[model samples]
Target: MSAARPAGPVGGVTGCVFPPATEARLAPARRIADAVLFEGYVLYPYRASAAKNRLRWQFGVLVPPGYGRDSGEHSHQRTECLLEPRGPGGHLAVELRFLRARRRTVQRAAAPGPDAYLTVPELELSDRVLTPWDEGVPESVRLLLPLERLTRPEGVEHPFLLPARRETEPVTEKGAPVGRLRYATEEVSGVLRLRARELPGPYGALRLTAVVANTGGWTAPPAGADRADALPHSLLSAHLLLALDRGRFLSATDPPRWAAPAVAECAGEHTWPVLADPEGGDDVLLSSPIILEDHPRIAPESPAALYDATEIDEILALRTACLTDREMREARGTDARAGAVVDFAASLPPEVLERLHGAVRSLREVSPVPGAADASGEQPWWDPGADRGVDPARDTVAVGGVAVGAGSRVLLRPGRRRTDAQDLFLDGRTALVEAVLHDVDGSVHLAVTVEDDPGADLWRAQGRFRYFQPDEVTPLEAS
Candidate 1:
């Protein structure tokens, strides 16, 4: 392939297309605009065929917002790729490499000239010669990048580690930022959304985010040294996101397949949905160390969870309906005065509780037409474990008494493990879970594991049934 005529880093080396042998070094690499960059660089004898001590270098990149194709097929990408000389360069006695970084006065390595080199004593993958630009892609929707580098010699610090975690809280004066975690909260529509952020080790990595729902009664528990008083509750929804650059690279490292999109790349929002872990390389980024602290007096800390407007069907029969958003807000007020006088959700009278649970269950078990073939039978990928909103209960959450697919899903708070008969039988074993489910379908399934959101545990909630969507489940046998 021809090398694209983009300005070279620092100095121009008249990049050229390397022969197959030399190109093989950059083998297993992805396509660039016109050429393929070696994942990193390598050095050896210049003798057309012999291996001598030569210089080699490579760089990992984290594509920021507004990167590749912004529309059409290649939207939402920060493709992980490489760039290198099409030809040779510099003195072989002492080798040097360069990488483009966010704006900064280039820092120097132990060597010279603004830290010309970098070193990593450890990396995620070893022995398997991590060739330049040879890294694979991941099938995730929101991809966050923090690239890490390695050094050939000890103490030779690479300059890239400086520009990380502007958004993260530092661990301590003496602590490395590797294992530390952070918790944050954002409120919308009077609901407090909790988030836990973590950055950890050894490589320039991808961002991993999970969103869950607070199905249980209490809030998520804070993370810190064991808190004897912490309440554990399972969460509801979870959604994961990963980002990408141009759509020209392979994703995943194991049995690797091309994750590159077929059209020109674009940058914007997109969703990857589902992904395989082993196939996708461990992130190309690493977060420095950090310390985690949980403070619940400020806000109840609980398991990470996510909830969307689509699934509110558990039939919460309030003593009176709010009717309007304003009324809802007033009734749900968090004011200290209101809180002091209002009855706690747990303290509601037995009649009210019975009424509420009964209404919800009634909605859950309502059949479409007096038991017509239970359209939700054993079909392809119908696990009785997913949250199938009030569809099966058409008489309640439907329009004009017509049956819908899965209008909303309701999960009881506080996780509950299942007995053999309770959960979806996986190899004859009860499915392990911490979620409560209530959907259009009469059956209530349990929330097993979610995709994102580190918060949300269901251990705190008392006895309550969950929703089960027969159509949305992916049974182990099918997978």
Candidate 2:
């Protein structure tokens, strides 16, 4: 579901445990004058043990790094957030944050340690963001534990940093991004290109594929008079750079080209360039992993807690505090399925895939399953069973409904355990299989299929949980 609150070693120093008077006063970084202050930021869904249990909130939208160190040269961005509020069936929701745990330092790029926070845009903390039964304060638990669709949609891209009007630019090269830039598109053909393969052994570069056309809207009328779903999505997926020491763009098959990138590996040549995030000029705003956190199918207020998950690293440091780039565009036309072909063999040229085909059909469908090999192998991308989940390898997991509340982590379906398949990998793509969650004397029961299969192997209906960690949860490894 996009659960990432692991912001501990980006720059250094996030030691605020909480309780020094809330850091003199406001302190998420002195407010930065008011930063981008979009329009939303509020989370308060309690009931870690019991109060009545309603608690809802699984938000994550960060994009800080307004640019400082030198402004023109310097790689230091800081923006941290963590909400995690799930309770009703999934469980795990205990708030209480007033700020103040000691150790300070804030003038810019702050929050490297002490919960680390160097935010500036729009300045938002939501008072307590979420508080409950606080004696003094420091009870901030949200390290990922209630995933099953809990609101994470805002597609077209733009994870955080919105204010320049909307933000959208920086296709690459503004102050040191390596070089090579220009996506320009009109769908002259298929648009979605990406050529730059560096594969000697461990993959020093790893990136190869082309399906481009134009850049946005203007094509698509063949799938057979298609209209409803209109289908034509394009996504290359590949970004691995955990950032503890060496991180930047990963999706692996043989990563660590001294660069380290092998997060899912559905193939061996994908390439995303850290998402390109985009950059042209106007204002700036970047971050948007996929999209469709939820689209009208409603039905989620809360449902977390399988036995307490431990805050999930503060929710991956609030999902990387947003991403930040600045300069807006909204998402450029939003991508009306006008371009993106991705033909590995349309003869191989015509400018290859036509140049930029709606930015590669708007690119956005790169599956995952490769931390090692086979946490169980197929049938788990959300649980696509009977085959509604699509089936790139097995299926999507179940589609939705067996149990998923919060809003849209992907449509919620949290429940799984038990792995091993060389580790796991998905060179095939497509994921689903969402719940398995066991244990009774303690609480937890959500199965869908697989009445029982160990040596026999039988729990079909689509699968993919990739990486748990109570002892050894691969999540779906294999690249």
Query: Best lDDT goes to which candidate?
Result: 1
Give the number of colliding residue pairs in candidate 2: 157
My TM-score estimates for the predictions, one after another, are 0.16, 0.15
Model 1, C-alpha of 49: deviation from truth (Å): 75
Query: Best candidate per TM-score, number?
Result: 1
Error of 1 at 393 (Å): 28
Kindly list the per-residue Cα lDDT of model 1 for residues 1-479, writing each as its tens digit.
11112221222121233344423322222212011122211111111111321112112221211221221111111212211111222100000111222111111133434323333221112111111111111111111222211111221121111112112222222332221112221110101111112123332222222221122222323442121111111100112212122111222221122223311132212222222112233211111011111110111111110111111212222322323433223322211112211223324555544533322223333234433334465222233323243233232223123322222222223222433343333222223233434544545544443323233234224333233333333233211
In candidate 1 the C-alpha lDDT for residue 204 amounts to 22
The weakest ten consecutive residues by lDDT in model 1 span: 287-296
Error of 1 at 462 (Å): 38
Q: After superposition, how far is residue 10 of candidate 1 from its true place, in Å?
A: 41
